[model samples]
Target: MTTLLALSDDFGSQLGKGIGAIALYAIVGLVLVLLGFYAIDWTTPGKLSDLVRTGKPNAVVVTSAGLISMAFIIVVAINNSDSDLTAGLITALVYGLVGIVVQVLAIRILEWATRIDIGTLIQSETYSPASLVVAAAHLALGLIIAVSIS
Candidate 1:
């Protein structure tokens, strides 16, 4: 009975530590994802949030794709990380932010090379097929980053 009690106490303490680590990582991850959202919003023309609020499908597609891409990169970074909780969170943040930047740059480069006004397409009230191209670019870039991190 005494041995069981001691084991329970040890387990409780370890559980507390694990919970704390998870909370810290979660908060950091959320912030990084928000940052990514803002970055993508800035790269594109018009207010993405406003468009989404008004039920624009093109805006929804771009924003949803960006969020998913950001989340995927962060998840991969967290999984591949083996450092202490804080260090791992920082590493994930770096990977996430860099992924966002690269994704934005890739879109801009594509816009220039292909002569497609990706920004205009994203902002259009009509459902633009070009929006899918932009969304796919982000997803492809995100997959590349996620694989590189892992």
Candidate 2:
């Protein structure tokens, strides 16, 4: 009976620490995701949120893809970070932001390589297959960065 009580106490303590760490990581991840949204918005020609809200197909695709990429970064960071929650939180933030920056830069580089203005493409009200390409690029970049974090 005493042994069982001790085990239960240990489990409770561990659960508390786990919850605290999750909270800290979640807050950091949210801030980073918001930053990613603004960064992506800055890159496009028009207001991404406005376009997405208005049912612009291209904008919807781009915005959703950007969000998924940012989420991938955060998940990888949280999973692979060191045991220290404080340090892990910092690592997650850094990885998330860096991953976002790199993905944006990749888009710009693709623009130069293809001699196409991705921003202009995204801003158009008409649906463009290029949006799918951009979305794939974002995911590819996210995956590459996430693996590196591990």
Candidate 3:
């Protein structure tokens, strides 16, 4: 138990160093998801804006795809390593979950900065900066994990 705690602490510190960059990466991924919705909205049957407004398939589809893709990529990246995959994968799962919380905070900041109520801009091509910030943080974390293990 002590060994496990020590290892986790060591790893967490390394990850914490790159938290900002990781958030940026997460935000980028979020933006991509939003963009997917934009494309689907234009090409699909119903109005994308309406679906997002109602929080229907639009929100579900976009968020799910982004998360699923992130999970797969993270898991694969971690698992393929010769080093500690469990630690890496678990760290990513936890870290990514926390980043969502970070994004919630980012949303408020973005609202203040841009004066564009994020709720209203849900389905549009224009995504708020919150998503970008979160993605940057994620990108940083992912790089750290990938490099640390390698």
RMSD of each: 2.7, 2.6, 15.1
Clashes of 3: 23
Candidate 1, poorest ten consecutive residues by summed lDDT: 1-10
- The candidate with the higher lDDT, 1 or 2, is 2
Q: Report lDDT (CA) for all predictions.
A: 0.79, 0.82, 0.45
Compose the digit string of candidate 3's lDDT tens values, residues 1-150. Answer: 355434664787778756754564465445544543444344333564675567653344444433443444344433443344345445554544443444334334544575644344445455455545434433444344334333
Candidate 1 error regions (>4 Å): 1-9
Off by over 4 Å in 3: 1-50, 53-82, 123-150
Give the Cα error of residue 86 in candidate 1, in Å. Answer: 2.3
Report the candidate with higher lDDT, 2 versus 3: 2
Where model 2 places Cα greater than 4 Å from the true spot, the runs are 1-6
Put down candidate 1 lDDT per residue, 1-150, tens digits, no spaces: 355434664898889989998998888788978888888788778888898889788889888988888888888878876678767777877776776787678767866777877667766778988778777877877888778878
Every model's TM-score: 0.86, 0.87, 0.32
Q: Which candidate has the highest TM-score of all?
A: 2
